[model samples]
Target: MSDTILTLTGVQADIAQYHILQGVDLAVPRGAVTMLLGRNGVGKTTTLRTIMGHLVARQGVIGFDGMDITARATSARARLGIGYVPENMGIFSDLTVEENMVLAAVSGRLLAERRDRIFAAFPPLRTFWTSDAGTLSGGQKQMLSIARAMAEDRKLYLIDEPTKGLAPAIISTMVAALRELKDGGASILLVEQNFAVARALGDHAAVMDDGRIVWSGEMSELADDAGLQERLMGLSMEGK
Candidate 1:
């Protein structure tokens, strides 16, 4: 297997005639979390969508585990162990949490052992197993979303904005859950706006602006550079 689990080279994608990604070159190292950061509408989500095959890339190569998957369908990509948790969580509002997980599991069936492991990672999922997913709290719903992805074996997780609109306390739980996933050797490509969570969980970072990557480097390096943070992330110590 390649050291990099996922790679995108010169990727160009368009959404309804509006070019969102221009020559995006990126790599997600094996067993590490790569943070994708940018202001709203900068094509962060579009980049992920392209990878998931929700939107086709007009050009460039997308390699996963040493295979070129640029033209693969979304179902094929999922079967290849690419899990996705969209910003909306993508849960069936009318279904119970267990029902949702079962639907997402491998072959649409989750074994007891797998269920135990997922519940261990997110205890709230166990508590709300019988409850309608739509009735869960925002944080719990996020947990369920992640749990559903884990119901199947996955090599890479493409997660977008897991903490959006979440409280500090809830964000902390989500952060810890992600950290645990990383510790367990799950490679993640995360699109997040919370700098704190980005700094906390990211092993490497990529910053996007105007649909292109402006910076890519170590997470610690980005965390320590206030000037770079302001320039790339539009923030300062005073939270301007």
Candidate 2:
């Protein structure tokens, strides 16, 4: 069995005239979280978006579960068990929480066990199941976003900035939920700004700069070295 669930090799992408993702390479190990960390505008989100097929890569290949999916449409990628929780959270404000989850399910049905698992991780989703998603607080919306993706038995998850603007308590909850998700043996490629949260959930770390991966190794190695953190993620380059 392959240890890697996803691989990006020499990937390049462009947005209009703006060139992004210049020769990016990444590998996400199966059943572990790999944190993609970098400064703002460093193409971390672009990397995830490229992997999710939200952006067409102008060059190179994207492989998922031993198959090349570079030319696959976004929906096809999703159906292949690669769940994406974008940076924006991608909530449907007008839709009820149940409706939003139903849409995220993709199978057109939320199975009992899946629903139970989602609720166990995010209780707020159950609280406002019939309510409009916009009525929920920011933390609740983030929880819903994660719950929706996690509702299915996915082989890999690409989560971008899951805790960007959350309160500490909510972040703690988010961390706990993600830890539980990791414990369940799921592969995740996470883009997190909070180093603490990244350290907590990531088993491996990939640091990006100038649109390419500059470092890749165990998360603990990065977390344990403050000097290295300062060198790679300098004072001015610490977040998204």
Candidate 3:
């Protein structure tokens, strides 16, 4: 197998007449957590959507596991082991947590062992199995979204804004859970606004500005460069 789990070369996408991504290039190494960081409205979420096939790429190549998936539909992409957790968490509000898990597991054809593993990794989800997904706390909902993806035995994940609107304690728990997923050899493409959370969990970092990737390198390098952070992320020591 190739070391690269996902690759995007000069990708361009548009939502209606508005072009969102212009020549965006990215790569997620196998079993690594690659973060996409930028200020709001920088097309970070759009890029993730393009990769998931929710928005088709008008140009460039999107290859997963060495196969070109640019034209594949969202369902086809999912069957290829690409899991997506959008910013909204994408859980069914009316469904119980257990029902949601069942739907994901059955749809993904996941084995019982994988289901057990997901529950083990996220005990809160197991605890709230009988509760409605919409009724759960923000952190619990995020956990459920991630757990559903894991239950699918996906090799690659597109996780957008995992910590948005979450409390500090809950954010910490989410970060720990992501770290655990990374350690278990799941390749992740994470879109995050929280630099602290990204620094704690990401192995590689890419900065997006005005619909293009401006900089990408080791996560530690971006964390240490305050100037870069301010210029690209609109973040400073005093906070945005």
Say which candidate scores most in TM-score.
2
What lDDT is reached at residue 149 by model 3? Answer: 83
Task: Kindly report which residue stretches of model 3 are placed more than 4 angstroms away from their true locations once superposed.
Answer: 106-112, 237-240
Model 2 regions lying over 4 Å from their true place: 236-240
The TM-score of predicted model 1 comes to 0.95
> Model 2 residue 137 lDDT?
95
TM-score of 3: 0.92
Regions more than 4 Å wrong, model 1: 237-240
What is the C-alpha lDDT profile of model 3 across 96-125, one tens digit per residue?
A: 988888777637365778767777777787
User: Distance from true position, residue 18, model 1, in Å?
Assistant: 1.3
Give each model a TM-score: 0.95, 0.96, 0.92
Candidate 1, residues 23-65, lDDT tens digits: the string is 8999899999999988899989999999999999999999999
Model 3 local distance difference test score: 0.86
lDDT of 2 by residue, 74-163 (tens): 999999999999889999999999889888887898888888878888888878889999999999999999988887888999999999
Pairwise TM-score winner, candidates 1 and 3: 1
Ordered from best to worst TM-score, the candidate numbers read 2, 1, 3
- Residue pairs with backbone overlap in model 1: none
